[model samples]
Target: MTIACILVILPFCLALAAFSDLFTMTIPNRISAILLAAFIVVAPLAGFGMGEISLHIAAAAVVFVVCFCLFAASVMGGGDAKLLTASAVWFGLDASLVDFLVYVSIFGGLLTLAVLLLRRQENAILASGIPVPQLLLTAKKIPYGIAIAMGGFAAYPSSPLMEAAFRATFVTTA
Candidate 1:
C-alpha cells in the first residue's frame, strides 16, 4: 500500500497537474490538495517518526513562503506555488529536496526555451496544424507545472518516503 502510494498517487497527481497546465495554463487546486493530504496520511503509515514528519511539514512551510513570495511578485502562478509546496513535503528538508528543486530549475529553464521557440513559430505551427496544445503557443505564461512534475518524477526515487517505502515493500524479512 505504501509502495502504491509512493508510486501511484504522487505520479498521478503530477501528471494530472502537468497535463492540465499544458492544456489550460492552470493546475486544478484539487491536485495539490490531494498531494498534501495523502502525504499527511501516508507518511506515518510508512514509518516516518514524528520528528521526520515535522521536518516534512517544516519543509512544506518553507516552500510555501518562497512560493508565496514568488506568486506575490507575479514571478509564478498561484497554482504552481501550491503544487510546488505540496511536492516539497515528500522530500522534507534534505538533499532530495535540493535535488528536486534543482531539477525543477533545470527543467524550467529548458521548458522556457522550448516554449519561447514554439511561440516564435506559432504561425507556422498553426498553418501546419502540427497539433500542439493551443495554449502552449498562445499563452503568455509558461506552464511551469510541467517542469514541477518532471522534477517530481526525476527526484521521486531518492525521496525518503520512497526509500523507506521501498525497503518496507521489497526488502526480504529473512
Candidate 2:
C-alpha cells in the first residue's frame, strides 16, 4: 500500500503541476508541499537509509539554492523553483538527478520555443475561432512547471524510490 502510494503520488503531483501551469500559468504551492512531505514519509518506508535520506535532502537544498538565485534574477518563477526543488528530493544526489536536470533544460528550451511560436500565431488562432487559454496566448512567461514535470516523469523510473518499489514487488511475486 505504501509503495503504491509512493509510486502514484509523484506522478500525480507532476501531472497536476503540469496541467495547472498549462492552463493557469501557475504551479500551486500545495503541489510542491505535498511532494516534499510525501517524499519525507515515503522514502524511509521504501528502505532508504538515513545517509541516503540526508543526501536527498541535500539534493533538494542544492536545487533550492540554485533555483532561488534564478528566481531572484527573474529568470524563473517562484513556483517553478519550489516545484523543481521538491522534485529533486526524489532524485537525490545521483546520476538520475543529473538526468532530471538535463531533461528539464532540454524540455524547457523546447517548450519556450513552442510557446513563442504559438504566441506569434495568437491573432490567427483567434480569428479562426479557436479558444485558447489567455495565459498561453498573452503571458510573457513560459510555463516552466511543464518542463519540471516532464523532467520528473522522465527521471522517476530510475529513482531510488521507484527501484525499491520494483524490488519489493519482485520479491513478493517471487
Candidate 3:
C-alpha cells in the first residue's frame, strides 16, 4: 500500500498538472493539494522521521517564499508558484532538492526556447491546421508547470522519501 502510494501520487499529480497547463494554460489547485496531503500521509510510512519531515516542510516554505516573490513580480503565475512550492517538499533541503531545481532551470529554458520558436512559426502553423493548443501559440505566459513536472520526474528517484520507500518495498518483497 505504501509502495503504491509512493509510486502513484507524485508522478500522477505532476503529469496531470503538466497536461492541464499545456492545454488550458492553468493548473488546478487540487493537484498541489493532493501532493502536499499525500506527502503528509506517506512520509512516515516511508520511514521519514520527524526531523526529516520538518526539513521537508522547511523546503516547501523556502520554495513558497521564492515563488511568492516571483508571483508578486509577475514573473510566475500563481498556479506555477503553488505547484513548485508543493513539489519542493518531496526533495527537502538536500542535494536532491538542488538537483530538482537545476533540472527545473534547464527544462524551463529549453521549454521557453521551444515556445518561442513555435510562436515564430505561429502564422504558418495556424494556416496548416496542426491543431496545437491555442494557448501554446498565443499566450504570453509559458506553461511553467510543464518544466516543473519534467524536473520533478527527472529528480524524484533521488528524493529521500522515494529512497526509503524503495528500500522498504525491496525488503518486504525480498
Candidate 4:
C-alpha cells in the first residue's frame, strides 16, 4: 500500500512541476534528479526477487532507449523525455506503468485538441482587440505536465473493482 502511494504521488508531483516549467520554458534539474534517483532505488524494491530485478532493469533500458529516439527526432523535449524515462524506470515493467503510459497518450491527445482550440480562440480575441498581425505569430506550447498528472489520476484507483467488474460482465456474456 505504501509503495502504491509512492508510485502514484511521486509521478503526480513531478508532473505538476513539469507542467509549470513547460509553460514557462524552464526545466528544473532538482525534480528530474530526484525522479532519476528514486527509480534507481525503487526498481530493486519493486522486484519480486533477483529474477524480477533483471526485468526492471531491462524495462528501464527500454524506456531510456525509446526516450533517446524521441529526443533525437525532436518530437519530445529533453526534459520531457528524461522525466518519462525516469518514471518508467521507477515503474519497472509493471502493469501500472503500462496503464500510466496508455492514459498519458490518451490525455495528451485531448490536451493537444484543447490547445488547438484555445489557439484559435486566442487568435480571434487578439485580432479583434489589437491591430497588429505579428501578435498572432507567437504560438503557445502546451504544458504537458498536466496531462501526465491527469494520466496518473486516471490510473490511480487502488481498488480491484475494475477487475471484478470485468469478471462479472464476462460471466454474463458467457
Estimate every model's Cα lDDT from 0 to 1.
Answer: 0.95, 0.94, 0.95, 0.60
Models 1 onward score TM values of 0.97, 0.98, 0.98, 0.67
| Sequence-dependent TM-score of model 2 | 0.98
Candidate 2: misplaced stretches above 4 Å? none
The sequence of per-residue lDDT tens digits that candidate 2 reaches over residues 1-174 is 878987899899999999999999999999999999999999888889999999999999999999999999999999999999999999999999999999999999999999999999999998998877888999989999999989888989998889999999999899
lDDT of 1 at 173: 60
What are the clashing pairs of model 1? none
Question: Which stretches of candidate 4 lie above 4 Å from their native place?
Answer: 1-9, 42-50, 124-140, 156-174
Pairwise lDDT winner, candidates 2 and 3: 3
Error of 4 at 34 (Å): 0.6
Error of 4 at 114 (Å): 0.7
Worst 10 residues of 3 by lDDT: 161-170
Residue-wise lDDT of candidate 4 within 72-119, one digit each (tens)? 997776766666665554455668668878887998898779766656
User: How far is 154's C-alpha from truth in model 2 (Å)?
Assistant: 1.0
Per-residue lDDT value at 137 in model 4: 31
Q: 34-122, model 1: which lDDT tens digit per residue? A: 99999999999889999999999999999999999999999999999999999999999999999999999999999999999999999
Residue 130 miss distance in model 4 (angstroms): 16
